[model samples]
Target: ANRLLKALFLVKYVDTFKATPRNLTVLVYDRFGLDLTGLGKQVQEALNLLEAQSYVQRNGNVYEYLTNEEQEIEKEIKAVDVDSAEVSSKLFRYLSSDILKTNKLKYAKNGQDFSFGYKLDDVPQGNQRELTIHFITPETSYSDSEIAAQSMGRDELRVFLGRDKRLLADLRLLLKTERYTKQRTNSGATPSMQAILQSKQVLNADREKELIERLRQAVGKAQLIINAAEIPSSSQDAVTRVSDGFQELVSRTHTNLGLLGGKVYPEQQVAGAVQSETGLFDAATLSALNSPGTEMESWIITQTGLGEKVTIKKIVDRFETKPYGWDLGSIEVVLGWLVGNGKVALSVDSNPVVRTEVTDLIRNTGKHPHVVVAPQKAYDHAKVAAFKKFCTDFFDEGAVPSDPTELARFGKDKLAARRDELNALVSSSRYPFVSQLAGVVALLDEVVGKQVDWYLTDFNKADELLEAKEDLIDPIKSFLNGQQAKIFDETQALLNTNAGNLGYLPTGSADTVKALLADANAFRGNKMNQLKTAADTLRGQIDDIVTDKRAEVTAAIDDRRAEILGSTYYANATPAAQESAIRRIDSILARLGGETQAALILQTGATFEQDDYPELLSRLVEAQQGGDDDAPPPKPMVSVKSISVPDASGVLESQADVDTYLAKYRAALVATLNDGKRITL
Candidate 1:
């Protein structure tokens, strides 16, 4: 018990002075006059016992002294080192003040008496004698108190008696009862005992109460408070009484008034104990908290704005765990306050109600609920404004916009209008006529080609315009088809008429040949190049018929020539007659050489006879018996003389001789003629 007191005294000494002036053993030996042989072991034992009691904890070689307040089963107050000069000085000043003093003062210099609130006339004379010593009241000291509680343990330290009761009690006693050593002295020597002059007189109940009230007021001004309930009722011996009662209360061992900032622990439970992670209680609590169907479930989604409802349990679960570290009940209270103040809107149907009915009923329902922080309206307005701005810019820039909205608004109508205009332009006649086709091509280039690029991105508009342009083809096609059909029908009719006329041309109709030739000339003269698709075909058919007819006519004319040349009369006739016949055939050929129908007419007119004349009448004297005509014999031939002339010029020399020869020649001729016989001259 004495050792415990010594340890407490040593700790108190170090705490009060902020320095240790001597070693433990030497200090104990000097103060208590103990033998030093085994003092080290005794001191160590005492320190160990103090540590076991949690009165002083050793950190390495340094010891931290715990106050009686820190030794509580539930609450603990650490013995905070008072290294702050301000705190220490302030404590010193308070303890030295008049409230703690129980002493008196008498003072004077020279013949004047020292007085309170002295006037100038009461000033001491110069170089006066020393102030006289005055008797002071005796007071209890903290060492005596410590000795009084020598047998006490933790309970003795529980009640705090301020710095004056703990450390400055001896000083207070010294100031209260001390007196000057010399009877007469100079002012310089008298100043050594000035503490006695500053000492407070014994405080009466009213004075103590007034001082405490002032102290309380000062503490309040400083944002501090004293626990007056811890103060004992006894005035004369209040410290001892409070200390004893606190010790007795602690000794019961079952009462657990928790320490500051800590929960009330069970009796006999050690402080700062470690618990298992998978302990039944903790595991069960975690299981309940983490369960999917539990009330805490989906709370994360709610508070994080991932889901709709913001319930109290969700708020608590979101904040009161992991990073936030708030207690559940504290979060509940905060949410309750918010709901009451209408900062948050909550659903009433939640299992555990968040706020009271009165508070919820008083909330304004007309205003929008502050659910999730968002800017939906602002975003929508901005989007529309941007769209409008883009549209305005697009038009103002002289560019066509191909956005869907722009296309829907303007492109479709523009295309439709363009289509209507094109329809009107081409409606009068077929487009792409030989004369107007170039202009149509230019229009298409200027209109569709220039504007199609703008609507390229808006495919529907492009397709509509393209469809309109495609519609332009139908009219030209229809016109060409009609023209082609007309040309085909006309050509077929011409071919049929010419063929029918040429078919009968073998009958030698001149008009048929003339009309056929006229039609051929017309067909050849009319250029079918400008005609549409069927023109070449019609021309080819007409040309084929003309060629065939010419061939037929040429063959017929050749046959007529052969027939005329091969005739018996032509063969037996004079050259003149044959020449006339040839001239006539040549004339016919010249008239219709290439004219097949005319030549066919000539060929048709000429015919070859089977026989030139019918057989002459039949011969009557066909058969006669041999020698039946013997009685019709003719007379014998008569003899006649003939004159002979020599050959050449010498033979007939004279004219008379020649005359006689002539007469003879005549006579012989007559004789030969009369006798029906040949005469030689």
Candidate 2:
């Protein structure tokens, strides 16, 4: 069997020589008509005989011809005979130079091995499993930093190239031929408009780079302005420029922190901003947000040093260890101490207020919001001063409202002196003045509103400022009835005489439509005052039962003011939660509104807006909707949106066939070459 196979192979080899003259080996000529009868029996026998002879054997080992130098000549013959040559170069170029511009490749003059660009992302796929995509990567991994950058680059590369193996393999060849891979993804003297389409990547890369650099700069600038920065957003457009000029300082800030600044949770952080130590001490306190027994004491114990009596001092000490340590406010310390004590006990404080709080507001309450409403003491003082001035305005220093001649008789020198004296204190001592003036005016308004009441007719008739009398209403109604009767009598007489434009004069004109219809059915309406009286009787009675005006007002003002004190004024916040509530009211009323930034800065303790502001917030969509720059602040409504899913869906796998299969395929194809001989599949 070995001799017959050898003879047949020799016959085929002679045919190849007869067909074309060339210096060739036996394997090259015997490329065709070389297969034995049955692959199992004949190939096995040939392999055994070749092994026994050991004289330039034709076959190797037990496995299929996946690889062997002896067979390489045949693969080369098969590849050329079967395919178009030019398509390979075009596809290869696209894969290498255009699709995956490698970092390592350099010169076009270099050979194939030196030329490169085959992004890891461009590698072909192999194995598959549910929730686990499998791929064969290079045996050696890159440095951690390089790996990170390359990962990003590879991710982007995969996006650019349509993750296809055949395309990338062709691209790898192109990259080798062009010897180009670097910043220039596609570099040519602008290929023909048609060529550019073929290499749109080369054309588009320039734009992409510019765009990327601009994006980086934008993020950098935002960071700079946001960090170590001051926004000159002012009321009245007032500016206090520094020596460097506002723009110059801003540019400096941008250089320092802007371009580097990112989200509070930024992807890449800069070693910038008003510097502070990383070591921070954690503490816990009660919160309004949590329900009774809903919160865990374990969180607090973990944060605070676990011990029997975790004292307030221990927590403070931890924070103080860092340079520029943040001072825990008294209330915070107290709350922390309370919780520490509570933690030591078995039962949790079930009070709504004592639940472990995760918010900042609970720790910093008590600060006041600035407002025009002065303390009651100041109000009373202003009232007292106002009474004397009111009296003096209508009279002489003797305090009389009547006898204007007697008042005029007072000397001009005395009057000027008295006026000057009163005016001087009216503002300085806003006391005994503003309130009393308002009180008198309110009383006047009350009397004017009851004009129809005739219980005090004499007073009303004598002076409009007084209440009406009872008999006055009867006389007025009678007189009005008589006048109405007389006018109708006269009108009937005139109508009978002339009858001018009878149809038009039949009744009232359309112009009186609104007035005619206005109280036509007033008796049918529900008495609005009845509902108000009922409501006020309940709520006001409830308020009255609380018998502590000072406590009520103090608590309200204290809570609001405290909230204001620490406000960052970022669009999303609480207190003056909406644009309407904060700017229109707070800014106008704030003493340092112009100097401050960050919405809450206008309150008290806070200053400028911190990009990473952590103030508790509630939303106010309706109130914020119509707010103008100078409009009053809107009320906030606490709202939230959430999605609950048992599990999040993700790309468990790209359904990818990984690199190992592709490399094996390529190697198998390459190995099939053998001395110019071909193997028909």
Candidate with maximal lDDT? 1
TM-score of candidate 2 to 2 decimals: 0.13
TM-score of each model, paired residue for residue? 0.16, 0.13
Query: Which lDDT tens digits does candidate 1 get at residues 1-681?
Result: 255445555665365432121255454564565656677677667665776666654332334455553343101112222233333333334422433231112211111111111001112222232121110111223343443343242221122233332123223222222222111122442453333223212212223344344433332222101111222334334323322333333323212111111122221111111111224224433232222212232343344465455434445445433333333333333333333322343333321122223223222222114322111111233443343344344223344432323322354345345445444655553222323333444444443433322332323233333443344334334444555435534544554545544453334433332343333122222323233223344345445655665556557656645754675434555566566556655665565545534334434333211111110000001111232465543222222222243332346778987887777667656655676443211
Q: Please give, for residues 124-154, the per-residue lDDT of candidate 2 as tens digits.
A: 3222111110111222243323333443312
Off by over 4 Å in 2: 1-163, 170-178, 181-288, 291-297, 303-681
Report the alpha-carbon TM-score of model 1 versus the true structure: 0.16
Instruction: Please name the candidate that would achieve the greatest TM-score relative to the true structure.
Output: 1
Runs of candidate 1 exceeding 4 Å displacement: 1-432, 449-473, 481-681
Q: What is the C-alpha lDDT of each candidate?
A: 0.35, 0.29
